[model samples]
Target chain A: MSAPHSATSANGVPTLDVARLREDFPILGQQINGRPLVYLDNAATSQKPVAVIDAIARYYREDNSNVHRGVHALSERATAAYEAARETVRGFLNAASSKEIIFTRGTTEAINLVAQAWGRSTLQPGDEVLITHMEHHSNIVPWQMVCEQTGATLRVAPINERGEVIMDEFERLLGERTKLVAVGHVSNALGTINPVARMIELAHAHEALALVDGAQATPHMVVDVQALGADFYALSGHKMFGPTGIGVLYGREALLDAMPPWQGGGDMIKAVSFEGTLYSDLPYKFEAGTPHIAGGVGLGAAVDYLAGVGREAIAAYEAELLAYTEARLQEVDGLRLIGTAENKAAVASFVLEGVHAHDLGTIVDHHGVAIRAGHHCAMPVMEFFGVAATSRASLAFYNTREEIDALVTALQDAQRIFG
Target chain B: MDLRDLYQDIIVDHNRSPRNFRRIDNATRMAQGYNPLCGDKLVIYITLKDGAISDVSFQGEGCAISTASASLMTEVLKGKTEAEAEALFDNMHRLLTEDAHGVDVDELGKLAALEGVRAYPTRVKCATLCWHTLQAALEEVDEPVTTE
Candidate 1:
């Protein structure tokens, strides 16, 4: 978790000392199937660094208590750490104020919050919610539910063969009725980095609010919600090497102030009178019940860990590694890489001609190479590609070229066995 | 565990060229099976003659294990009595779930080829989907069975 001691490669892009950095993650050192584990499933959920793990343990050991109610010392300490975790998350997204950052279960809950709270209040009958085809199920389903409840039509923008959003179609879908435009900053299944800044601007131009699903974006790239001019942004901590069951939702303060609380619980209420209940202010208003305090603390530690590694440096290193992986994957005959987007991030999804992805998954696991092989919760993306499933090797900053080579070897073994 | 144990030559051969990989157009009973985890789908068809299965075949798309499982199940279940197929289904289920101490592997015959799936817990559903579908068809369960 110390500063990234990664030496810069030629041409001045900072290349991480992945060898040394890998040492920080204990899980990476272990072996699977008698061979060293080659984890290429970062897009599924990243392996947590020791710092995040230690943070969770330390919270439970020292500051474990309910937040915001008790006057006891443990309560004060726990509340401080939990709120400080909120500030760290605010800084992670570069939001203007911590008040805009609401802690949720994960991106799915974050999206659902906006869909129910904002969509229910604002969406009128015949209003539209526009989204892209490459969105994860998390982003798509909430909007569909809201649309169904409010009698608003759900519109989908198509993506090209390369998995890039068809901007023209996206623009065409945007009109007077478009109430909310939700899109993923990066496609989880394809790793296509959408032009979200422009998309947000277009949504604003159409008088519609835009929300960016940053679950797949925060791990690999630096995100500034203000710079993107997004109305709402959502991110998952687990996908960024933090603990599971915790995430952040960053809404513009004005929008959050106007939207009603999504859930009612102990923390979210300021006063519960016999006559009526007065809701708490921004952030806490939407966070119902006791928050995931330990999760938040671990997420804070994960943010610190990423900062020390440097997001720009991690991006450059992983980009180089992704290129290496794509090229090496092409070495296997009958292997067809899906999602050949011009602008891509940490994922490489593909299908072998003769082998079903499920069979291929089993084949590679024997070699200690763990890659995700399924719909990736993006069934529409699978449908678009005309595949039942795909074998995806989603890289991380810690993954090595050697690991990718091992993956290729294992893939060849699959071909040999099935050939 | 060695990959060969799971992807044995027989399993691979059956996957490459599956037996009974056809639809019985005159089928008397049919049932669908789905494994949502891997998106494996298998449809089992059985034509009964005198309350006994006279013709059997399968049609569907799934992973190697599921495809080979369906192919093998159809081949073995042809002309089997309804009760006989049900007993075999129970045996196949036990073979996949039990440890070495529990089930008799020698009696399983070609179904023994699937015992390796015990090592890969996630793949057990793949090997069982066909058997479940065949069981459903025998009972004439109209709804599709899912290996959740």
Candidate 2:
């Protein structure tokens, strides 16, 4: 059974302590366009807290050295810190060990790694890779590349107009020919939190591995990879309030052992003598270089910050904000909420009949509210919903109800201009 | 929502009662332009009368700025010769992209409805998609079309 809770912590309520969270993030107190900055673009790249920033700065200042080969004190310290970060990530995702976690540039690169490494080796001609229609382009394009290269087929599982995956149809799409089923744990464009655990189970039942793109889900909710039974999972550090150029790709140990190294380079080699070198073990086999040491440390700090704030707290607060936001947004004449999925994160995507999403974003920005506009890198989702684009206001723990009110007021003015 | 600064009264009026939002039967040269970024598409139908643009119409789906821009573009180039139409297209592009071009804003004609597009960096492409398609149709015409 699912956890019997209202997405709240054991305190029976979500305790965000917004004032405390705000203090951790220095960027929150700044002014932009003559108004207090209301950062609603968390899904894109969340603002970093002081701890994560300091972690990155400290690593470069004191622990700046190449890892794995260093015997000196500073290099040893840097290597320890890098590996410690990997351990933190392993713990965060509930993976068996740190060996299963491979660091990459971001979720895009993480997905691409699996596509090139495991996908190339396993997928046969006429094999099918199942993905949802609402997948972000990162999830979609990598699978497309793999299919193109391996002569495999890419099958799209359709979602209902409400943005929920048609479970019956999804189950029907899976078969013996299905080599892999890749799906997003949450829809970045629509904020639909998919039931990936069930989907993963279904894929495994069909004898196919499942890769969950947790770029959107990881930041907003608790992600237990083992609980979800995901064979592979990917997440970006930037979305988790960490530095850019850092992400995690967690694959089953057996799968990682079987898959070839994506890039053959210095560290990935077991014994390089120009004759044919054996590849390194899991995790390092995929890393292949002096990894983003500082970035990984920063990501560890970010994960710590989120844990401190509590994911359940953030999820509950954002859910309340989304509820209020939806009600307020619906009050505006001619305004329509695009995605009404039963399970959604705090994102509110809407279209104001005559006003374009791009125009709405510009007008709202004038009020110091920064929201995302356009396809949001999910072009197929936009095409599915029959909208050119939408103005998306994605929320985080620091976002307040008052900021949502400001968004509503700004959107109301948008109606007057477009009308 | 500073209507006077961005969405002028002219823009709202033109958006409400669009001048030319119909299809042209047997249009000599018809082509469609799409701004995939914003999902704006415009299908331009042009009919030349003795090497001059006699009838021009458009029908497609887009936001207010793009649709009104399309509607206004059809109205602006209806009576003008091919050369005048081409010059107007250039002026519109300059106006949208480099608003500081000193091309008198008065010359914007009905296309002035899209001046709000200048404030919006992203939608500038939506405003220009129709004008670009019109220019494409003009370029296709053989034998230098009559100038104003």
TM-scores (chain A) of the candidates? 0.99, 0.96
Question: lDDT by residue for model 1 over B1-148, one digit each (tens)?
Answer: 7889999998998998999888889999999988776788888888999978899999899999999888878778877888888888888898888775656566567878988998889888889989988888888898889887
Residue-wise lDDT of candidate 2 within A232-338, one digit each (tens)? 99999999899999999999899898888899887787788867888888778998878888999999998887877777877778888889888888888888888
Give the Cα-based TM-score of candidate 2 against the true structure. 0.92
Q: What root-mean-square deviation over C-alphas does model 1 reach?
A: 1.2
What CAPRI-style quality would you assign to candidate 1?
Answer: high
TM-score of chain B of each: 0.94, 0.84
For each predicted model, how many residue pairs clash, with residues at least 3 apart or on different chains? Answer: 0, 0
Model 2 CA deviation exceeding 4 Å by range: A1-11, B1-3, B99-101, B112-116, B141-148
TM-score of each: 0.98, 0.92
- DockQ list for all candidates: 0.84, 0.49
- Model 2: what is its DockQ? 0.49
lDDT of 2 by residue, B12-124 (tens): 66667777778889988777777766667767889998878889998877666777787888887877888888888878878887854686668776676666667767668
